[model samples]
Target chain A: MATIAVIDYGMGNLRSVGKALEHVDARSRILVTDDPATIRRADRVVLPGVGAIRECMAQLRRLELDAVIREVGSNKPFLGVCLGMQALLTTSEENGGMEALGMFPGEVRHFTACFAEAGVPTPGKVPHMGWNQVRQTRAHPLWRGIPDGSWFYFVHSYFVPLLDDAWTAGMTTYGLEFTAVIARENIIATQFHPEKSQTAGLALLANFTRWDGTA
Target chain B: MTLAKRIVPCLDVDQGRVVKGVKFVDIRDAGNPVEIAQRYDRAGADEITFLDITASSDGRETLVQVVEAVASEVFMPLTVGGGIRTPADIRRMLNAGADKVGINTAAIDNPDFVHQAAQRFGSQCIVVAIDAKRVSGADEPSRWEVFTHGGRRPTGIDAVSWAQRMAASGAGEILLTSMDRDGTREGFDISLTRAVSDAVPVPVIASGGVGCLQHLVEGVVGGGADAVLAASIFHFGEHTIAEAKAYMAAQGVVVRLAEDP
Candidate 1:
């Protein structure tokens, strides 16, 4: 049985993440924990978060889960959601510039100027809440059952932009084209909430359970 | 493709049972909260909001239980509204598996409570629900005032500015409900929705008074809401969320369909 540890470092909607995992694959052991030992013992790791990037990073650091995330994110079949995805980046522009885990080479940016810069007639919403189509840029194990352009639920103000195509697994356009899914070998992270995304999301989670941490 | 506008079905819950009330009165039992939520989830509801209309303090406890039961069964985002006053209330609902908690009366009473909740729980989970009534007549320029206690207590605060203030104070989304249109099934007040949606940087959910699917479309197309929320139409089986999304998609408004290719 695959024991997947969902890192619970005081982020938003951790329960929903755990419940979604159970719903997707009943046999797999889903652990919602803050302890580093249990996380290391688990076969796979899922880092889920919602809210401000600064607070997310702060909570991770305070709980010493940052080091655990850095360790497992590189070796295990790792999945990051929303703020957890942002935390993998080197830096974030939110809360006046904060340092991230540097798991990936990028910076999290806000969505205010992107609308005008993208030449959109009306300035898009800041949080970028609701369902948006995620275009698969490259094939990965995570994209197994989901179609190429499937809608996923998103709720965030900041997103990682200007990513290298090598690391970007998926691309989604809001006011401007932003990297929604970033993957590097074993690590896969999404800007959208897979737990809240219904059919496609459930498929993604099911894939994560069986994945062998390969590209 | 662009971000699809969301369709949310709201359940007015009173004491664990899903109830349908017209203008917060003439209540009738709709069904079980979990069962209806499951139906909406299968029908491709972008989100679900449970507004607790229970008057007694003891009955209010059932809201958390309902949220817990629904969250366990349903996969979509769930929001719990009604009587969310303190940070503890917000924490309780979120712990109960609600993705977000809607703040209506408490926010009207104290705007800083929104900020405090946002600061503690993160703005993404804090949905500030505004109940607005048209204070201006047909002849007068359109103006809306904020109302509390389920649209009965008028605060005289301008709805647009209040929405702006709430967003500025760290509200991630605004649930804009038109008291004038709420139970009347007249449709969302486009002017009110537009005013609030344009004023605030956060995403606005145009809610209340949805008689048909076209009203859902107008909430996004005409009103510029990021999401549209309706209760009775969805609750009473007048229309499913799938039907609403299809109509919106046909009307050139971007919406996510259940079987989208």
Candidate 2:
């Protein structure tokens, strides 16, 4: 059985992530501590978060889990969800000049400018809450069996812009084509909350559990 | 692009137990909230709204536990309402794992509460639930007035204006319920729904009077609501989320269908 360690950082939707993993028959455990040993020993790691990108990075740094996260992402199967995924970027426009986990060479920016340029009526909205579909960019193991144009639960205003096209696994349209999910080597992240996405979400979690930690 | 219609399952809970009744009377015990929530979650509900029907503050504690248990078991957004008065109550519900806290009677008593709660918790966390009843007048027969305190009192506030005010006051969403259409299984009031949806910029969840899948479809497409919230249709197993989504998709609405697991 796969022991999936879900990192909990006093943020959003940790229980749902853990429960979704359990539903997929994964031996899921919620890890609130920043101890490197626990993260190192886990078969897989799931980082789930919701909130401002800078606050999330600050918390991870304060708890000294950033190094451990880097170590785990370098070798093991690491899944970043929502803000957790955004934190993997190099920088975020939120909270004014805060560094991210730097797992991926990308920048997170608010959707206001993008939405305005797209001519959407409501721009600068803090939270984009609802169900939206993701358009797959290319084939990857993370989206192994899932069909293209599959809808996932989304609730965020900021989006990640990957430096390279190879990092974006899927893109979704709210105001414009934004990176909805990403994969690079051993690291996989989704802007959508798979936990709240029901069966498709569970299947995604199951796919992660079945991953052999190989790119 | 037309917005995707949402299928929401509403749980009328009292003292941690889900209660069902005809026209909101003779409440029969259904099941545990946690159990019911998991069932709905598996059934592919877009969202789940738990209305704590009990009036007492003591029931509030049970509601918190229900929210916590459901949050742990069910992997979906949870909106909890009923007896949520102050900003502290909203905070408590959010801290207890509720994604949104719904305010009803409090919003009627003091509309400022909506603005304050929205400012404090962000508009996304504050949902204003409006219960409206059709009132016949000398001028127009289709006049609607806001009802609060579990539909016991009439505030004489126009439902459309109330919805607009709530949105202006920073409410993220509106759960508009038709008191007359509730538990009737007759279908939603398209006029009331359209009025509220047209009045607010935020997402409007049309509640009450859902008998079949078509009603859900019309509630969104015709009624112009973002989501359709129902209780008996889902609680009685009249249709599953997949069936509902398929029906909506057939009707030309963009719905998120659950992939076979």
Candidate 1, DockQ to 2 decimals?
Answer: 0.78
CA lDDT of A76 in candidate 2? 89
Q: Per-residue lDDT tens digits of candidate 2, residues A1-215? A: 44677776656546667766776763555454456688788888988877556567767888788998998999889999988898988888876767898888768887766676679774422356678877778887778778777767877767886447788788877656678888888888999888877666767888898887665
Q: Tens digits of per-residue lDDT for model 1 on B147-244?
A: 88778788989999999999999999999999888988989999999999889888999988889888888888889999998889888888878788
Q: What is the C-alpha RMSD, rounded to one decimal, of candidate 2?
A: 3.8
- Report lDDT (CA) for all predictions: 0.89, 0.80
Candidate achieving the largest DockQ: 1
Clashing pairs in 2: none
Query: Chain A alone, TM-score for each of the models?
Result: 0.96, 0.91
Provide DockQ values for all models, in the order shown.
Answer: 0.78, 0.27
All-Cα superposition RMSD per candidate? 1.4, 3.8
TM-score of 1: 0.97
